[model samples]
Target: MPTILLIEDEAALGMIVKDSLEMRGFTVQYAEDGEEGLRLFRAALPDIVVADVMMPRLDGFSLAERIRAENQTVPIIFLTARSQTADVVRGFELGGNDYLKKPFSMDELIVRIKALLGRQPAAPEAPAGPLPIGRYRFDYPKQRLHLDSHAADLSNREAELLKRLYDQRNQVLERTVVLRELWGDDSFFNGRSLDVFITRLRRHVKDDPQVQIINIRGIGYKLVV
Candidate 1:
């Protein structure tokens, strides 16, 4: 059974969600506002977070930004009524793993939670050494990419994306496959996030002309080294 930190302003809705999750054998830590959610989050970290987009003291986006600053591995799922595309994109940008619109079914939420939890990478064993990538040396353990005298720190997602590309160098890494594996789905928003990471990885290895991560059009990406 996993622990969930649920932050919602509406007391009734929060209680319903909490009760529902508890019935499914999940430990739910319910909070009426973002500030208290953050406090509980710091006190005892949960396996996953389900938070409403709007809150009284601290908004969901702000809370997610803060959480990402501390722990990048925990899964975060945002529940919101805002239907704007920009808001959805902003949620993804702020490190939300998934976004569910208001009036969403508990079954869908539970499925998403289970999918995200199942996809979480297990702790890796000690690495042999920094892996070579053209002129860059990627230290996956430390999430650092070094080139010459300069070193670029990569986020957890960035490191994972780069590692996958490097592992499949010279081959087409299917877009849908990557999306499903990394993001849990091939949704448009997750595709955009993947593009952002690709752009970042390109920037990191730009100093070396011999290494390139090229888009395969509608297919995927190919890392040429």
Candidate 2:
């Protein structure tokens, strides 16, 4: 069973979400503010985190940034009422793995979680050359990534995204090209979602001393190795 750390300012809604997730076989630790959320994160180190963006004290963005700095691979999902492109981009920039708009359905949230958790890309017939993502060896054809003694499975989307970055290593990969190639659209939501995936890719290579994905402000991203 997966343990979820839920950080939301609304007490009533928190309980509801906790109860709902528990019903779905997930253990949950609830925090009503970002400060408490950060404390719980350090103490428990839950599998996935769901946090509200507008909480008092620390705020979700700060909490996610701190969490990312501490743990590169732990997944974070932001829950926010604000749907502006800037806010969504900011959330992704802070290392958010996903986001849910306020007043969302529980079922949709569950599906999103399942998708994020279980997404897998079809393996390639041949490896994508000698690509070393930091300490990890990316076997793009097989959709497998190995780091140290551990291995991580990459979804098709993840692999494709990483492949593109590797192809454009050391320079900016245009945001529009990335979106059109990977997601087939350059809509605001797609852009926001791309940020989440970028965060994930960053986490995958965070341990590598020679690899980094640098955001090019309003333009695109540069993958330096």
Candidate 3:
């Protein structure tokens, strides 16, 4: 069974989550604060780390940072009530593999955990030529977007999302479709994550005025070139 280190300050929620995961056949190492979480993490390395952003000792971001410094491969998921785009981006920057907003369903959490666990290390492959998008060239294999003289490296998720958008460029990439395909469900928390990614993609292509990822409000997005 894959071991999970769960760091949550709220006693009730912690127990509930711990019980739920244990019921699903996972070995859970539960901690009520970041300090305890870190101790547990060091003592018994876990397959994955699920931590809340706000905690008594060390916050989730700090925990992730420390973990990343020691082990770069373990997946870290942040649980936070804060929905600010900056907060979400910060979590990713701190090496968090995923973010789950508060009030999230147990089912959604389980799906995300399973998805992360299911990922296999990709093998090396030849780099494919760049695909043109307005004035930008997207090198999908390298996960890089280049303009005239600048290049921006994209996360794996970002590259996948951009490719999906490019595939449906000039047409609406239905919200539900993208959510289900990329996140395994159309849960509200996953939708929030998608919005953050969309915002990041827009920033990536912002240098090219001709490239636009228009939000279809309540529907999805359209990449107009």
Best by lDDT: 1
The model with the greater TM-score, 1 or 2, is 1
Candidates 2 and 3, the one with greater lDDT: 3
lDDT of each: 0.85, 0.80, 0.84
Clashing pairs in 3: none
TM-score of each: 0.77, 0.65, 0.62
RMSD per candidate (Å) reads 3.6, 6.5, 5.7
Residues 28-127, candidate 1, lDDT per residue (tens digit)? Answer: 9999999999999998799999999999999999999999898876778999999687888788777777788899899889977886665455423436
For model 2 the local lDDT of residue 32 reads: 97
Model 3 poorest ten-residue lDDT run: 118-127
- Please give the distance, in angstroms, between residue 133's alpha carbon in candidate 2 and its true position after superposition: 7.3
Query: Pairing residues by index, what is the TM-score of model 2?
Result: 0.65
Q: Which digits, one per residue and each the tens of the lDDT, describe model 3 over residues 1-225?
A: 999999999999999999999999999999999999999999989988999999998989998999878876577889989988788877876667688889998987887787666542231232468889998999987778899989877765677678888888999999998777667779776677788778888988988899999999889999999
Candidate 1 has its poorest 10 consecutive residues by lDDT at 118-127
Candidate 2: tens digits of C-alpha lDDT, residues 75-158: 778899999988888887776767788899998677656544433242223554647866778887655688888887765457
Q: Per-residue lDDT for 158 in model 3?
A: 73
